[model samples]
Target chain A: MKGTFRASMAWLHTGLGLVTGWVLFAIALSGSLSVFREGISVWMRPELPTVPVQTVDATAHAVAWLTDHAAKSSAWYLAVPNHRAPYVFGTWERPDGSYIQKALNPLTGSPDGIRDTLGGEFFYRFHFELQLPYPYGRLIAAIAALALVVGLISGLIIHRRIFADFFTFRPNKGQRSWLDAHNLLGVLAFPFHLMISFTGAVTLVTMLLPWGPQAVYKQDVMAGYTDLDPALESRAASGKPGHLTAITPLLQNAEERFRGAGISQVYIYNPSDAASLVTVIAGNNGTVSTLSHSLTFDGTTGRLIREHVETRPAVRTYTFLYGLHIARFTPDVTRWLYFISGLMLTAVIGSGMRLWTVKRLRLPHHLGHVLTDRLNVGVLGGTSLAFASYFLANRLLPPMSPHRAGHEVQCVFIVWGLALVFALIRPARRAWPEMLAACALACFAIAAVSSPWTNPVTQSTALVSLLFSGAFGYAAFRALNGKAKQT
Target chain B: MESAGTLRRPLATAGKSLSLKRWDLACRILAALPGGYALAAFSGICLAVWLPGLRVERAMTGMLTGLLIWPVAFMASFAVPDGRKMLGGTVIALLALMGLAALRGWRP
Candidate 1:
């Protein structure tokens, strides 16, 4: 019974790991890194240098400048600076209604005109929502997160060694290396695995929660969100027109009210109306979640109606957990930590796939290991090919090509498709070697070919970018040409 | 020349050669920097509690709540050690921490 049980457990883990592993890892890794997307974007652009004595006047000035220049905005979000964040970003709804983000200069408090920066938001979107169409993509991502929880729990139950494995990495040990890597990955943030599982699952609880709303609340799901947050009803307009009072006063009042809460953004709604609401959202640096501790003031009368800080006990706990998951007001180092774990999670998925193929090939059975080998090469090789090609296409395509984004996406899929094709014709062992080398060279060459054509950066920056591409290409090429022959 | 017989032996010995401790190590290496971040995430939250301005108390029930994760994560590392190994590693790590702390004070 014991032997059978262990065998079953192993099989189940392997199966589960193989099935949803890639998606789960991708989600985890991307979400992890995105924790610091804002910070990373600033560092990457390096447009904003630190300055002291930045004023609410300067911030208001910037907002005014943006509002004047904004030919496309209906609503504007002005991101106020925190202790760690250097610059503020104003997000506005474009003509198409998509959120367009612009960085605000800390010095002049004006729009800095830095463009093409989706920032860490892209990764975040990819991680959780995966660019899938709204409800479906979100649902699938949530399910994958649930699978991760399962994988994490089952892994703990099955692992016999609780300590002996801490600092063990024996290199050139074939399958042993993989096993070591897997264990090491699992162990590193075992705590994170546990927290992320619950938090990630909770992050999507609206979808996962027992169809209580569908069964009970029916059409009143909006009521659930509103009930959970009673603050929404505050400052609701009574249909009278009046220009807004000075924003500076509201900002000051909010700062005083929240005290340590660290006011980050002042959201003004129903402006020039008697019922306008001015909400001061707390900065995320010191906070754990995105649940804003807001104090809403009426527009004309200037009276405080609701404060998130003054919520009931049950609602407060609910908000706290939600905040923890959203990681609204986390610090710089913490966000980086999120990013690092995210990268590791990606590696976990990739490695798990590699292991699946490796084991399948090693065990030559009635079914030839051909499919497994091909799958390994296709997924691993194809991912590299697709990413490299996308970068290449990004540079090579016409600057004004209406189809540039589509074309870049096409190139990615085309290379990915070629990988599957290559696997089919050749022996999996031979296919891996040749395709990897091709992918490497293609990656290296594409960067070189496109550097002069459409790159927007300076010569040095473009060269550095090419060099970066070359490094990865070289690594891939070297790996494919290694002494470790396909068995 | 004597390999045909030996080739089969490996498959047979696969089960016997399996090391839970080794497997544990492999997972950790894979976990990498993110693993550290995961801990940092919680600790980051906990640090919020330490702030004087935020009304969090030492009496929160969940203070010990997260301690449970340390064992789970550690055990997941497959770090089951004898009394001596665990004690020795802990002592060494603590000594290192102290030295670093002392250096931090001195430098400042």
Candidate 2:
């Protein structure tokens, strides 16, 4: 019975991994890129330079600017300057329910006339949304995450030699080498993979299983979300007009109360109204809990309204899971660690696909086997090329081009589609090297085309580009030199 | 090697039941989807009721628990190797949870 159970798990792992491997790879790779989303945003906007400034004063200046220009706005969100993002960002909702976001110059407290590109937000959104309309795209991504959980669990259960094969990396053995690398990557970061997949699925749990909340809240799920994160709590705008009080004192009070924990976001609800209130939420840099310690102050009188520090175990567990998944509390070194782990996860899926094809290739004239082999190339190679093309397109496209961000995303899909076509026409052996070489060239070019030494963010971007270029080059070389043996 | 032949033999026998295999695949797929989802929700709610929390916490925890367990339920539907048994086990669990909830008036 034990042996049979292992066999059943092996079969389950193979089927589940193959069926959803492509989508999982795409999600993981994009998420890996998004680890440096803020840096990428800074790099994309070359005009923004890093500078040292007090976050409290920056928020005060941004709020001052908003007071003059958006006195009647319903609400205002102030993102204080930090290391990754060196500019004060503000977004406000108009009376008509539209929002305008702008980067305020630290010196001038005015909007930075940078290019209207999606910047890092594109990859961050595409990581889960896949650029499809809300709810449906999220739904599909959630289902794929579930598949990943099953794949991880079943793979763990079925593998017989866990410790023995921990350090195995036998190159040039083709399929055996791929399986070794796959197992090595999976086993090394098994905890990370399991945590990321499970929490990721839990992130969308309310949407996936609304019945629990519906039963409790009687169909008002928004209230559930608000309860989970009280920073989302809001009050309607009172029509009574009033003078706006200075927000600097309120922000200073929040900073004092939180004991120098950086303020990530400050929201002014019903600004310039009698009922207005300001809420300052703690930044993720201080702790591994996404639920920020918050302080709400009356907007009219600058009086402290409410203060909260999460103590509930359930909320703490949920937020810890969220924080672990997002990794927002980590420094640059730890962020890179996450990026590496994410890359290994993607490689695990890719190598599993390769193993599937290699095992099936021992047979002859099986359409399923051939198709899987081609798709293996198309997905693994095509997605890498698409990502490289996204960076290349971002650099090459005109800054003022209308729909510039959409076009950049379109370039990704277009090149990826072309790779698919190439995979169909060319032999799998030829397609691997060709697509990989193209990706290597593109990555190298992205690094080469950048200026020598502008800032740390740009320097880091260039370094990452070079690293990817070298990795792709090595993969291409291996594919070109290795004999295509069916063993 | 004859080992490859031996590995292929079971699949060859599976191919002999082409129509029956198709039916079995369809049944398992159904069981994995709806059957598994129901089982997850029922069991999740049952677990949530035992947890110490308020209404929102319990609801969120139950939803999270359901989401985490749904994948396990899905794989179990295929792992058991018998679609009927998988379906029957899920239904029985669901009914049992329902009985508990109905008898106890399950509320957060």
Candidate 3:
């Protein structure tokens, strides 16, 4: 009976190990790759010459420009450039107050052709959003994360000599290499693994517990928000046009109020009206999740309203934790650590799946092994192909072209599908090298093509990217040059 | 004293009826969910201060809530050895918390 129970656990382990392995690997790998989302964004956009830190006059500039350019705006937001960001971005309500975001040249405060880049935000959104319409993709990713968490926990319980095998990675022992790599990576960065799961769950807590705030507050979320950040009630003036002045004095006043910490944004509400307010959020650069401090003033008389004169306790705690999740709050050293850790997390999951498939090769006809092997190729190889395609799509597709994003995504899916097909149709022995070569070819081709695009990143950076792309191509060719080597 | 010890072993080790060590592990896992619910719910409560928008305030509150999920699980496991019923308890607690929040007018 005891033996039977153990056998059942083993069967359960094998079943899950085989079933969800590739999906887990893909998620981890993509997540790790996305750690450099910002860097990649920098590579994509063209260089913008730095402007003088003219934020003292930012609110004034916005008001002046909008008054001349966007008179009769109903809804508006003012975004001032900071040390980290290269441009000021904003949108205004046109008589009706709907939002329309645009990039402003801080020097002249005018819209330019290049103001369209969302940069790292694309990958950040893609990492979880998966581009599927609404809750479906998000729900799938969340369920995958839960599966990953359960697998990791069960793995720890099942592992016999966690420490003894911590550093022991034996090669050429069928599943040994993959298993060792998985165990080593997983154990070393176990904290990161665990945190990612829980925080990921935290990120999805709303979805997980949708009923809480829904039931209790009767959906008066705005009222609830008031409880969180206390706001002053500004009396609405008589339903008449109130004469207004420029926002220069108020801008300087807010800057003076912030003193050392620079002002990152200026929000002018009810502009040209008596009840108009200007909120200047002070800047602290290079942090995750952009919420900051500053002063909110009456844009009319420039009287001080709610001033974040000091670091409020609740706000500080909130920013710090968000920083941890986004890896933005840390210095370069810590950010690099997070990136590396994220990468290792991907490798661990990838190898874990491969190891399981290899171990299961003894099963009848070994169809499962064949499926897992193909899956491994499809996921890892397909990932490289997808990324390469994105780079290619970005380069080939017109920058101003409205369908650019959609085309790029299509390229990724198409390349990934091709890789999967190639994996399935070809012999497992030949598939690895074939797929590697294919990925390399795509990467190099894309890198070569990208040079023609007038992107912002420095030429030196692009050339280096090209060189690395070529290097990968060369390695793939060299590996496949010989007879196909089966694991 | 010996009889009491033996009685505890039957329930703790072999577990109830046909349940065994795997069941214990399952219990641990099951117990964890409710605790996680509480922890997350607490974080949700903190976030109500800045509802809808996942602003800095909400993010900070979320971190606090995220940490609670584990401890709640740990506590539930230690206090109630039964695997399934505590899950029921957790659901109740979560539902109640949500209902209370909704009753208070939390919304989109």
Candidate 4:
């Protein structure tokens, strides 16, 4: 009975992992890159000056720019300059229901000379959205995350010698080697895998399992959200034009109220109306919880209207789990650890998928095995190549090109689709080494094109790309050597 | 004649058992996925309506609890080999939870 139970779990783990592994791999790899989302954004836009600017000064500059250019806009959202992202990022809603995003110069507050691109936001959004239309991508990602949680737990139950096999690796043994690598990666980062996958699902729980909230709130879903993350009540525009009060004093007031917590974001609603409101949100640099501590003031009079802070245990727990998954409050070392762990998780999924095909490849070759093998190479190797192409596109695309950001994202999918086609046409033995070599070349090209000496962010990004190039290059060499031996 | 009849009877039984096993496997898979998810959702609704807390807090706790319950429910669906018993038990629990939620004024 015990033996049968373990075998059943093994079956469950294999089937679940194989079915959901591709989407999980893509999500995990993008998520790993998104660890340095701001840094990548800064690196992609080399035109932006990286001079450190004070938050207050940056806020003032952003508000001044918005007041001049977007006075007729209904609302303006601004993110003050920080160490990681050294520019004032602003988005305003136009009366036509469209939105414009621009990075403002911290010093001059001008939206001049900055290239248009999603920057790091592409990876961050792709991590959850998979580039699919609204709600669908999020739904798919949430379900995949839950499937990962189930896979990890079942895997833990099936592996009998988990500790004994921790140090095991047998190279050049085909299926054995793949299994060993999968187990090693899975075991070494087991806790991180569990935490990340579980928390990832939790982050989207309200979406995936909305029945509870829906039942309670009936039709007022927005009320449920307002309760979970309390925000200041929005006021209607009076339609009469009023003088907008200065933002510096309002920021100072919020800072004092926060007791030294930095203000990260500010939102001005109805900036040109008599009933305007300015809300200041405290940064998460000091806390692991992503819950915002905000103060709203009258935009015209600059009088404090309300302060929103959450002390509820359930909400705090939810925010903490969400915060942990996003890693927004992580310091430098912790952030690196998150990145490395994310990569390890990706490797686990990649290797496990490879193991599935490896175990069956020795049997009579079937179409199922053939398709899985090709897709393993296509997705595992192709995604890395696609990500590199995204970076390459950032540099190669003309800065003034229309829809430049959209084109950069298009390069990623186009290259990825081409890689998949290439994988399908080529033999598995040859495809593995070739795709890996291409990925290595792309990484090397990214490193070569990027100027490493400009700033720490660029320097580190270049170094990381070079390191990835070396790693992929070595894997390609091993794969080629194995192919030669087989022949 | 008797020997031929015995041989044919065993072959027929073997074929029937094979089909039975396939049906059982399909039922279990269905139970694990959809049935387990339903159980989790019903449990969440129960908690949301019954838990003594603020509306938001109860709702959030309910959602988190449901997420935590899903994997366990998935495993439980497979732990028992008898597919009919496993699925039927899940359905019964879901119904009970739904009843409890309804009693607490949960509309959906």
Q: Pick the candidate with the highest lDDT.
A: 4
TM-score of each: 0.67, 0.90, 0.71, 0.94
Q: Write the per-residue lDDT of candidate 2 for residues B1-108, one digit (tens) a residue.
A: 443322322221110112226666667777788887876777666655555668767876777778867887887776676777677777788889877655646653
Which parts of model 4 have CA positions greater than 4 angstroms off? A484-487, B1-20
Lowest lDDT sum, 10 consecutive residues, model 1 chain A, at A208-217
Q: Which candidate is the best by TM-score?
A: 4
**DockQ-derived CAPRI band for the predicted complex in model 1:** incorrect
DockQ, candidate 4, vs. native dimer: 0.25
- What does candidate 4's lDDT look like per residue over A199-231, in tens digits? 999888988999888878999977886786566
Q: What's the DockQ for every one of the candidates?
A: 0.02, 0.31, 0.11, 0.25
Cα-based RMSD of the predictions, in order? Answer: 13.2, 4.1, 8.4, 6.8
From the highest lDDT down, the ranking of the candidates is 4, 2, 3, 1
lDDT of 3 by residue, B1-108 (tens): 343222221112111123335766575556565556464655466455445554434544554454455444544443454556766676666677666555645543
Q: Candidate 3, A368: how far from true, in Å?
A: 5.7
Which regions in candidate 2 have their CA more than 4 angstroms from the true location?
Answer: A68-73, A94-101, A483-487, B1-27, B47-53, B103-108
Higher-ranked by lDDT: 1 or 3: 3
lDDT (0 to 1) per candidate = 0.55, 0.77, 0.58, 0.85
Q: How far is candidate 4 from the true structure (C-alpha RMSD, Å)?
A: 6.8
**lDDT value for model 3:** 0.58
* TM match of model 1 to true structure: 0.67
Mind giving the per-residue lDDT tens digits that candidate 2 earns over A62-113? 8888888898888888878787877777788876888776667666566645
True lDDT of residue A2, candidate 4:
74
